[model samples]
Target: MDDKTAELRDIFLDATGGEGTVTERQAERRGSLVDVDDPETVDARLRDLVATMRERYDFATDLETDAYLRLIRGFYGDETDAALADAVGVDAETVAWARLDCHLVRDRDRDDDAPDAIRERAVAADREATRANDRFRDAFVDLLTDADLSGRLTSDSREDGLREATEDIETNVSL
Candidate 1:
């Protein structure tokens, strides 16, 4: 098309000695869109998070994101919080804080009653961590995870989850 392009194409033709079309390549799948249900895929995503967004979320525990993956794995695997704490070398309270920070609420009370609210709690809890208020640190997980097992978080409630989380956090969790 242009002089620079023609020169590069001639160089490519001489080097490769081919008629000219280069094969396109596909990328390895990653990110939220990918369903990480399998164990290997889960580990890859966790490692990627540590590399990319470890600082992005004000995580409560000092454990590496590599270790926190175990916490998340155990959590979704339905492991008890205490057991997860032990696995991740932290106390159970730290486990709860991490869960809330990661937006993995297990509250049964608000499942059906306030489905979208559950997603908002994830955002709010991280903000609360930024405040470093002992009160918020102590109460948020319990407040979010209260009540016996009931329904579950709504699958489609995350469209505007961030804005809702900010408003709800400011309104309800005043220092």
Candidate 2:
């Protein structure tokens, strides 16, 4: 990989709190791998991470949400276009545009309507969340395509499983 690619890979790994190393024997014992090499792999392993972050970390404003996205994206690549798009299902072009919109929206900085700002921020969060979810879906699909898993896991199934996993984590954390 080139320097940029390597950097992006590292960012993604760090964002997901991954150590970026997995042994086959260990995977066999644990039934999972860690520090995935590609977008698909990262998505599969960290499907619940985004939701966990959203639910557990309190964000007071849109700025916080923006910061969260930046942090998550940083874990992938600084470019945003290539790294985020690959991580998510969207094409790099689409991500570029969404990011542009995000920037424009931020630049507008119109908070006169607190209700509107809240609503817009909520929408933005949902958009980012959806993108992250798509990355998980794409990763699962890639796994199925590679015959890494028994059968293709439906998006709904993957989502439900993630939700359950997040709930379990929350329960455990609260204990």
Candidate 3:
């Protein structure tokens, strides 16, 4: 194979968690009906292997696996769920639906959608719910920002001798 073909094969293999070898085994076991040279055939076989992995090992669905792979490859950004879904050959709706169906996503009750009698009670409940959501959001944002800042600060400190400044602060705080 050429360099590009070899690289693509490596990527495909990695995405399937090294299951390309398993695909070869399955093809051998099935007496060579599969044509690995054909792109369509290869995709169909890989899809089947993905399904078998899900059925046998309780692995994530193909869409979820694709999302994870994209994230790991830095192809998906913080707010690019739609792009990730598109790259994975699935829709954003399907990603959400699968997450909800698998209980990986939670459903929140909204007061605006409640009936009149329930609306009043729900409004009160929503106050607490909204507060909780705000707290969670704040915490999540803090974590992401802290992680990003830490990475940048580490790099900058190493480059500009700022680590000594941080050490000085640490020493003063400890006194």
Candidate 4:
């Protein structure tokens, strides 16, 4: 072995008390920081996250914090906005607004009737937010200001424009 290699081996042996054979260390699996599989734990964790989000932002949903979390769970769990509306006895438009407030946007959130400026900006901002793992609501606010439009994201009489495949995904148990 070269002088430098022999020196490193000696240092390694000294540091490891002469057991100098190196074993490959297994890589740790990376994932969510919190355990999310337990329903009760997930429920509590989501509530806390939502509560913190509410304190930081102005939410369009008037639902209580816990109710809002359940609404989000149902949405990510594949329940349509209409079905969630029925469960809450509100219009789907309301549910859509709530969904946007929570940053749970899908491509179908683009509205044909809305002014193209608002529609385009909302879609772009939502997409960028998803890609960056950031808040769509905050980005939408900036985009709306930049476009100089009062963003009426959607109106009454519109339907869910997303395909069924797009509507269903793994339940997002986080805010």
Q: Pick the candidate with the highest TM-score.
A: 4
Q: Order of candidates by TM-score, top first?
A: 4, 1, 3, 2
lDDT tens per residue, model 1, 1-175: 9999999989999877775766656677553322433457547756664444455555656777766677666765689888998888888767776677554556651356544644466557645556654343333233323222112333335545766777656454767
- lDDT of each residue in 1-175, candidate 4, tens digit only: 9999999889999988888576857798664323334567666756666676677556666887666766677765678988888887788877777676666675666778755644655565475457656853443333223222322333221334444556667686976
Model 4: residues with Cα > 4 Å off, grouped in runs: 1-35, 113-132, 135-175
C-alpha RMSD (angstroms) for model 3: 19.8
Candidate 3 — number of clashing residue pairs?
0
Q: Worst 10-residue stretch by lDDT in candidate 4?
A: 148-157
Model 4: how far is 151 from its true place, Å?
A: 40
Residue 28's lDDT within candidate 1 is 75
Clashes of 4: 0
Per-residue lDDT of 1-175 in model 3, one digit per residue for the tens? 9999999999989988977565443444442322333446534543443344345333234455445334322221354546656666777655443332222222222335534533443344345336445442343233224445667877897877866766657443553
Of candidate 1, the 10-residue stretch with the lowest lDDT total is 142-151
Quote each prediction's TM-score.
Answer: 0.41, 0.22, 0.26, 0.49
lDDT of each residue in 1-175, candidate 2, tens digit only: 8999999999888876796654335444443333244656555344354345446434442233333354344433335446656655556444533443332122232356434644476456556647656443354334333433323445558888989888856443553
For model 2, state the Cα shift of residue 113 in Å.
25
Pick the winner on lDDT between candidates 2 and 4.
4
**Superposed Cα deviation of residue 37, candidate 4 (Å):** 1.4
The parts of candidate 3 lying over 4 Å away from their true place are: 1-64, 71-76, 98-150, 155-175
